[model samples]
Target: MKLQTLRLSLALGLASALLAFPTAAHAQPAEDHAPTLAALKALQANAGPGAGVHAGDGSTSWTLSTGTGTVNQNRPIQPDERFRAGSQTKTFVAVAVLKLVEQGAFSLDEPIGGLLPGVVTGNGYDDTAITVRHLLQHTSGIPTNGLPLPQAGPDGTYTLAALVKDGLRFAPAAAPGAAFHYSNTNYEILGLLIEKVTGLPVYEAVTTGVIGPLGLTRTSFPAAGDRAVPEPAVHGYRGARIGGFYFWLDGTVYEPSNFYASGAVISTLKDLTAFYRALIGGEVLTPASLAELERTVQPGAPGVEYGLGITAYALSCGGKAWGHNGAVPGYFTQTLVTKDGRHASVVTNAHLVTNVPSAQMMKVLDTALCESRG
Candidate 1:
């Protein structure tokens, strides 16, 4: 990262830390919030505590948190406690790239191989055949690269370039633009591509471009060697080997640097809701850019499709909630918003083990957006 860019990022994050969101200003008239609260508590019960949430419609917003902060279970999980957003970082990367696109820094249809040169090659991967859109939509055909098990390498395997190179051990999943294969290699490549185009670290680009502009005071990317979660965090957990047996280990101490642009973002429930609301509401993106981000491709799931780093979850009540879900060892989280502005963000304290069931989580979000409709 450039010294100038680092200074700008720190300045923006510090200055915005004191800004407040207009949570209750938009009034949608009173509605029963009991169901929302109930849904969150149910998530806590199954997800191993820290079921923190921030949800709202166009005119109303609210937050709720259940259970205690960590293993000792001494204090309640605060609604604003920061947690890893895992793969959701892709959404931020997509936004940054799109902003650059608006400024003529990128062309979605253009080959990113030309931008990053030899960064993505071998293992049947050819950067020349992959376009920016292919990367964003997970159609680059890069095999799904797995992260080191938290027990093996808590902080993650390595950096974006390292991960891209590591991904070549397996052959390509398919031909570029062949299908939506859901590869982190796609976004890892995006991080490198962004750096090449802007001459700034991907984190710096996202901070100045998205976090700062959105006034997401509580949202940030973890810096290198910053293994400790910032204070007042809802600690995450996963299984770890101990005495020849497995036990719950606090996963919060791992390095976020290894996640790079793929899943290093740390944010609170309120920030999660706010960021997605702003992005989906057209406050952070130009109309054409937003449209490009929302263009969907089937990812082999029922009632679900992916756009540029965004996922559309089918609602039980008839509309789709768009956003992303992230799982980074100890933390499993999701943030979604409808086109009409109804939205929810939830984070469970554990993942990989004693974690929230994917279906249960989907229902938790779906109910948050659907119950009122019924």
Candidate 2:
């Protein structure tokens, strides 16, 4: 039940990326994506056998992919292809909750005990002390047991309640709002809160609150009990070299309930880029709510700040991009958009575990954003 998403090595694999850059950041025109594509291609050794990039703004956009979508065949991963977006779903879920806040469904400072009642008991936790803001900001003092304990029901689907219960089994990581502790339990609780208020499933509530409003055409959630990836997907793979032979495990059909509200979003590069752009551009939330989301704090990560569900990454090239990185089992996705409207989303059909050069992925994002003129 362990996922290889953000539990990644930040070790920079900069040699290949530094040598591969073909253009200065100032030379890239608004419409040119070739440079970004080149950076993505250079990461094939780590991100293969499937990788894609979808970037640009509302005026112009570009899509490119290298490597095969299948294990044996040479079917290339293409643009607008669907893949699991992992924890990127958190930003969407956070927006959904904030939209509910705008609608006065509940306040961000409301205690969980008041909102859901009786759900936040025991485990040395105080529901009243844990606010919605704490959960969103990962300061809820919840342990990180949510991912390790994936207790699915008989149908292989995980209930948000079950996920939260497993998370509560462990004692508080710290006193409420004491430290930045990224845990799936906080989001699972938010998912439950979303359900309680809207009387709709998490997926339905998010669609009505965020996706539909944003016109994310190809983004969707897999229906309950369904494990099939939608058509034209970048099939995720996990590979290992044993002795002299190499093997790959296709995780494209990974269970939708595996991460529930904490992850488990099926999306495309185009859809994700557009969503992040809108989010960073202030189209998704009210000015007040968006301000609340951007009230960030250092999460003990270098050049990165944790906000509500999104993160702000300080680019080495200067400036910051707001978005989230996502990974399930085999799929990994990174999306970042500047406040100035430039955005980039890079997705690969492989977990960033093992010796995979995750820093190359970061380089792709930096190069894409830095190279953009708009």
Candidate 3:
């Protein structure tokens, strides 16, 4: 399957990696305990793949990595190894835009036509009709760049203008603010906005504005054409469904430049969990901004309803956790942070396959969050 199409499934809540609830109660003792280890082990053992799950409660953290780094091998997955964070980059971009908003540089309701005139008009896309808020909320009606397999290598150069034009070739998905339709193109426009406003590339802006200030030393935004993840990274696998069955193939070297500000960030569980806590815990945004960041569109779904840069999920155990989950071709990550400050992150090496650590993994994540309650 194409990566953007699969990612769109994630946007529509079809392939939401953040499980709301699970039935089996496999609770382990909390004191000096690692509740996710056994579940993760079982997950890898049963699925024939490696996985990494991490949970933190602001003060303490635990990680469990099982299976092999490569297929048909015994090399254990590293607890700190990085993976392509996919659309999680949206959260970073959202935070940057919020910072710009907080600085009085732009208003959420500002129309795109005012921000970038003549840049977004093409193939039925009305740049003047969409707003920055519409872009952040995925209600901009922009369509995704329908690349079957992105032809860009890690070193290839492609402009954001080119990507926006690529997306414009397709008809608009819906009218502005008509309904939620997640498109990577929305963030691509935002990336261009950042560059236009700040005169820095999107990656440089995020690095200086978000990653560096947060002290996320292990996280990185790879330069264009830098297909290789930092050393000590786990190999990513491709799971293709064929004739009602699935097969696995190696896909670790997949290039990320094509995703750009939409989904190109790479991070480890530790860094990713820290980012979730910091983001949802009110560190990166003002109280008013955080409230706006979490303002929901639905009553019961809570975080399931999309917000500015985050998704608020109504935890099955009562109370809501704010987070966003991301999926690329070879990796899928579910990162959740409860309002009470519990954070959980799960990462896998394979993509779009049957049983990509679904319920079993959610059970582990829930137990981790529940343990933080007491």
Global CA lDDT computed for model 2? 0.78
lDDT of 1 by residue, 178-295 (tens): 8878877788788888888788877888898889888888888876566777877988865422242323446687777667788899988788888888888898888999999999
- Candidate 3: C-alpha RMSD after superposition: 7.1
Compose the digit string of candidate 2's lDDT tens values, residues 1-374.
Answer: 23343322112322221111111121123455666767887765566466777666556766666666665566656657888898999999999989889999889898989998988889799998999999999999997764455577787778888888888998998998899999988998999999999999998888777888788888986655678778878877665433433345566777777688888788888898889888878877889999999999889979999999999999877889999998777787889988888788988777845666668888888888887755
Please, what is the whole-model Cα lDDT of each candidate in the order they appear? 0.75, 0.78, 0.73
Instruction: State the lDDT at 255 in candidate 1.
Output: 76
For lDDT, the strongest prediction is: 2
TM-score for predicted model 1 compared with the true structure = 0.85
- C-alpha root-mean-square deviation, candidate 1: 9.8
Ranking by TM-score: 2, 1, 3
Task: Give the per-residue lDDT digits (tens) of candidate 3, residues 1-374.
Answer: 66565555455653423222112212222444455676666655434356776776757776666656665555555557888888889999999999999999898889988888887787787777899999999888875567643444354666677777677777888888887777888888899999889999899999999999999988987766678778678777664433423345556776666788888899888888889898887889999888878875542332367898788766667887777777777787777888667888877777664455556656657766766665
* Model 3 lDDT at residue 177: 82
Best by TM-score: 2
- Clash statistics: count for each candidate: 2, 0, 6
TM-score-wise, the better of 2 and 3 is 2
Model 1, residue pairs in steric clash: 26-59, 155-255
How do the candidates rank by lDDT, highest first?
Answer: 2, 1, 3
Considering TM-score, which of the candidate structures 1 and 2 is the better prediction for this target? 2
- Where does candidate 1 stray beyond 4 Å? 1-32, 149-157, 239-247, 354-356, 372-374
